[model samples]
Target: ECISSVSLSSLIAEEFDDFPDAELILKPISDGGDGFLDVCRFHFSGKILNYQISTPYDNSELICPVLYNIDSKTIYIESADLLGLKVVSAEFRNPLKLSSKGLGELLLKIENDVSSGKININKIIVGIGGTATIDMGIGACSALGLKLFDVNDKEILAIPENFNKVEDIEWDNKTFPFRIDLIIDVDNPLLGRTGAATVFGQQKGASESDIVILENGFNNIRNFLQNKDITDSSNPTFGAGGGIPSLLYLLLNAKIRRAKDFILNDLGIGRLKGKVDFVITGEGAFDHQSLMGKGAGIILQEFEKRSSKIFLLCGIIRNEVNKKLPDNIFPIEINSFFQNKDESILNIESGIRLACIKIKNNL
Candidate 1:
């Protein structure tokens, strides 16, 4: 349904309203992706501050929400709001042309706000997922004073298309005013068969030919950095968000934490009272990837031992992954209840309601 976890949890609770005898423990979690800011707002007392920033394509501006917690002196940012795949139109989903200038703009805004005494914060938590660009964070670094030059000493734009032309690089001398923490779910490395360009390029509108170019583009940057005596970023999590987090880690010393650990630290599994009768969780597509440190996987891991039964209601469920699930875990593909794909999407609410009814009948 493309809705927030808070909204989905509320909807599920309403569907099971007739079962008043049972207690509903709604714990909405985020694996540092689309609903990161919403999860923060749900768990913490904060005010949503809107800031105008450039979009991924940089052809327009977007107003993105930043969760500011004055008491905690922390700010939360969801990368999806700035450069997510969902934000870019299908026709304009070319990673070669996209720029993460908006993410840089947002960071600069926070820096300026802190320096001017407009806001006091000690930490910035960024959810680096769902990005559309794979420019090795060059677009973002450019906004922070990075400069790229060609062999002829001509300036080069910070985009994948120009990566091959880049011969020299310059970094921003300014240091960030606060600590930066990046939360990521995937474990792929920055460059390789399992890396960003190869694994995620197609989803970002990259063709087979485009993926080859993108891989070379990433290699150009790595070679440049290696020549400068910089340690290569081979960390698995560095691959998340089109290698954006990897660049941020090298350039800004941002700390990277797995989404599962981050969520567990914030909401421990032990906090839930009594034995849980049923655990209901969902995502857009439940597949092998979902088990790879995604929110749904974390939910399943934590509640499997505590709950009597777990309901995995997803829009589309891959049978291969479903077959590997535990006996007590029930996977319901919402589309099975509808006539067609379009009908399923249109009646998503009803599909979920019907799924809940089936669960109720079993109880």
Candidate 2:
């Protein structure tokens, strides 16, 4: 079993100390964003190339890379750099005025690097979560030259405090060298109760008043884009970083589908049916979000269809996955395993190995 992040690593140490004879071995699991790109290199015969882009918080610049598999005609980008909250401190974690410009820059860089490959950017599943900035998609559009200007025709750079005053939007992206498939993790609407403003705004540090401003902001941008014939599943950046999905749909013609479906179908998870005794997966949390549409939930559903045993391990699991959950699905939260923060996060490798070990032993 493999884990990711420091917390999982520490947990494994504790496990080793507790049960010296445990048969399982734990390694780290990282997406392309961190060390996983290197793991990818070690496991597969792909070349890792580097490019510089500002970190998500805009505090400094760093060189991150996209992995290319010449034989597969595919490129891999680790969005954790931009999406992960590690770059932002608690103060800046406030989504109000948080910018996703780094993400846009990263995407543009990938597009530039793939010039010689001649293969279209078919699949782009951004590991979305832990984002600090929530300019909806404004920061990203600005980085890509999709200008949103005020009535005076002066450039409106920062995310407007509220959407009520958005005057106009301009975009001329008729041609791009490649196509993109965006894998998203949520189903938040563009406005109102279930939308980004109502649900995620507060956690992002928006007050009640700020929520009003953000709601209006998202609506204004949604209107602006609609006028220009750029719209998406929700017509704005609703989910993943405040309307990032809608922005991708309009500007990039990307689809905002569940990440699990994309990964499973493309990776041929069905082909692996009955190949393994049990399956385990998870995310930051297991909640209503997982049941509606999540990579983990979808994977479990797929396994259910195949009559395979499925287990979920999460940092935290909601009392209910959904109002009506299937009988076969089982969720285990390893948070109960640790007595303190240091212990919980000690062996933390994103909790995958621990989750896996628990699942294995239980089965």
Candidate that would win on TM-score: 1
Q: Tell me, what's the RMSD of every candidate?
A: 1.7, 5.1
What global local distance difference test value does model 1 have? 0.85
Cα displacement (Å) at residue 344, model 1: 1.5
Worst 10 residues of 2 by lDDT: 24-33
lDDT of 2 by residue, 106-207 (tens): 777777655765445554445444456666666776788877677887767656463456687778783455556555566677688888778877776778
What value does the lDDT take at residue 91 in candidate 2?
70
Candidate 1 lDDT, tens digit per residue, 29-123? 88898888888888886888889998888568889899999999999999998889878888889988898878888999999999999899999
Clashing pairs in 1: none
TM-scores, each model vs. reference: 0.95, 0.77
